[model samples]
Target: MDKHHKINIEYAKKLGLKSALVYQYVKDMNSDTKLHTIIEEFPYLSNEDVGNSIKSLVEQGLIEFNDDNQIITLSSTIQKTKIRTPISNRSNKIDKSWSPSEDAVEVLQRAGVDAEFIDGLLDEFIIYWSERSSTLVSYNSKFIEYCRLKWAQHTAEIDTKSVPRIIDKNWAPSEDCLDIIKMTGIDDAFVRLHLPEFILYWKEDGRAFVSWDIKFLDFIKNKWNYNVEVTSKEHTYKFDLFDPYADDEDKSKKSTKGNIKDLRKKYKI
Candidate 1:
């Protein structure tokens, strides 16, 4: 006698042929089977392909892994009738109140994603897809992909910021940072005027920071706001280069006053 495996054609179409094959194998075994044993059964497929198939099955809620991740079994949600029937292809626009399924959340949590982080992205994700004209058969799968991509990017940014280093003389604000500053209506010349001072101040302080771009942005915003406030208050004060009555202390403050004067004359801010 020979054993027969029932492969779900719909699953094969949705999740590659390999995934459907692996799901059927797990269904038939009905026992906690080692991952390596399954891989050995499929000699024609590469280990990477086999691994991806198993991951796909797990992500789709058709299969699950034991705590150790060495054993695989069918999920409790799996049904024999459901496997035999083709999945419905009826697609509709995502609802404004749509949320990811529990299975999707569990898969992400199993992959070590933080629950709080996942919650934080829900609104942005919902708004983004709700505005689109597209529809999906399985939002859970899409949400899983979205969450994984975002988590990867978030981790990359954290890794970049964690390693603190001294600011080099050659460093300057990135184009993206400059673009954001420009969008706020800050003058390019004003930014240039403060660039050297900003760099010198940090260099002299000898304090390493996670992000100089952020520090520069804060510095520029504060200085620009202060300049605007001072200019508005002293709209009538005129700086005289050679005032006989001007004291040395007042002359020392004249540099800042002069810059503001120049800013008013040039930008009319």
Candidate 2:
């Protein structure tokens, strides 16, 4: 038996289910085999799985297949080493199942991401990193952190309604939302403070808020600085036009006015 042809359970675990089986079969054979022969030998693997396994084996340097020949052969490097007994560790049988840490879940959830989205991210992340020759991520913490930041950044980008364009005509900002203003270079604290209003301005103007962080900088660069006081005065005029004493035909309309007025004062429109 050639050592190059032999594989340990750990190596097989990394190769995963279909790839592991393909590797074991390749190791057992004395000569090169066609892709169809391996598929015929193992009836369970789907055509797609067989193809993926072959690609994985080729990437890992365990096997070689030339499109010209369409035959699978154990690499000469593997053929030169002495082989050992086949894998017997049932626990090492590989699959793609993985559980994300609770902290990682919480981090994403705080940013409005859910389980299904995280699962997809994890699948792509695992597949990408596992195939690379040298992984930069040496710890689970780094991986979790990567998921958390990327998830928030991307999630914010997709959520069309997350950053609303207008909360009533009179827009206001809270202390926390003020964080957005600090990052942008616009000097006016009022503009920084009424950042949400600016978001609403863009929204009402039919612009998509693609990047929550960048949109502010862009707004300031284009609009906010042009006629800052006029924007402020117009919002105030709209606020005054609202009749607080108007007939509340549908009692629900009272709350609407109150909400508008509250937002007006809160944002200092």
Candidate 3:
């Protein structure tokens, strides 16, 4: 088997370094490859880095995944002629009226980008490149790259705006979180009982989370379930040990001692 891998410089220039490396590896395989195989091949790159590069390759129509998402194959759209040609030999300055090719637009759309969004970016993209002295072999390739970056930034900005901030001292569960707990038949008082401890522990630990409400929900549910189980066991034990002649005060003392032991066990204190 051949160990040498050939990379298309045109694709490399358009996709950037990591994506170019991944593209060549996939192309060389000539068969479906798994995500882990790519990751393993590049020991220096982090898992997230490999994943993002694969995403870029897909967006640019260089590669695609199978139905199970475990196998990757080169896209039929990739042309051997284009890959073999040296881009620099044919490089030319961007024309003032340059627009993306229909194929380039189709590739972006196939990646789930909105058509109107692509249209909106046209004038700005043309103006920015036209003013630059740099030359490119394929303006269509450059356009696809530009659109992918802008779309990523636009969506990231929207996501950042929607969430706004991290966990704070004034953090509290959202109404939706409370409603979910209510649906589980856990009483509101039980939720309130653990609220202070939850807030104090999180605030003191000082870790940022995207949604504190979700953390609170999980914490409350676990604590509630544990309490229900303990209470049921205590009730059964009391029934088994019931004595008609036992003093009421003695029974109360025993119950208090048992609760203290349970509390100590819970806190590991």
RMSD of each: 21.4, 23.4, 20.4
| Residue 77 lDDT, candidate 3, scale 0-100 | 40
Best by lDDT: 1
Q: Residues 121-176, candidate 2, lDDT per residue (tens digit)?
A: 77766666566654221123334444554554565556544564323444343322
Predicted model with the maximum TM-score: 1
State residue 28's C-alpha deviation in candidate 1, in Å.
70
> Model 2 residue 6 lDDT?
41
Model 1, 147-212: lDDT tens digits are 765665565458577777678887798664564455344767888899999989888999987667
Candidate 3 Cα RMSD after full superposition onto the native fold (Å): 20.4
Q: Is candidate 1 or candidate 3 better by TM-score?
A: 1
Q: How does residue 155 of candidate 2 score in lDDT?
A: 52
Total clashing residue pairs per candidate?
0, 11, 0
Off by over 4 Å in 2: 1-8, 77-269
Arrange candidates, best TM-score first.
Answer: 1, 3, 2
TM-score of each: 0.33, 0.26, 0.32
Clashing pairs in 1: none
- Looking at candidate 2, what is the lDDT of residue 60? 71
**What's model 1's TM-score?**
0.33
Clashing pairs in 3: none
lDDT of 3: 0.67
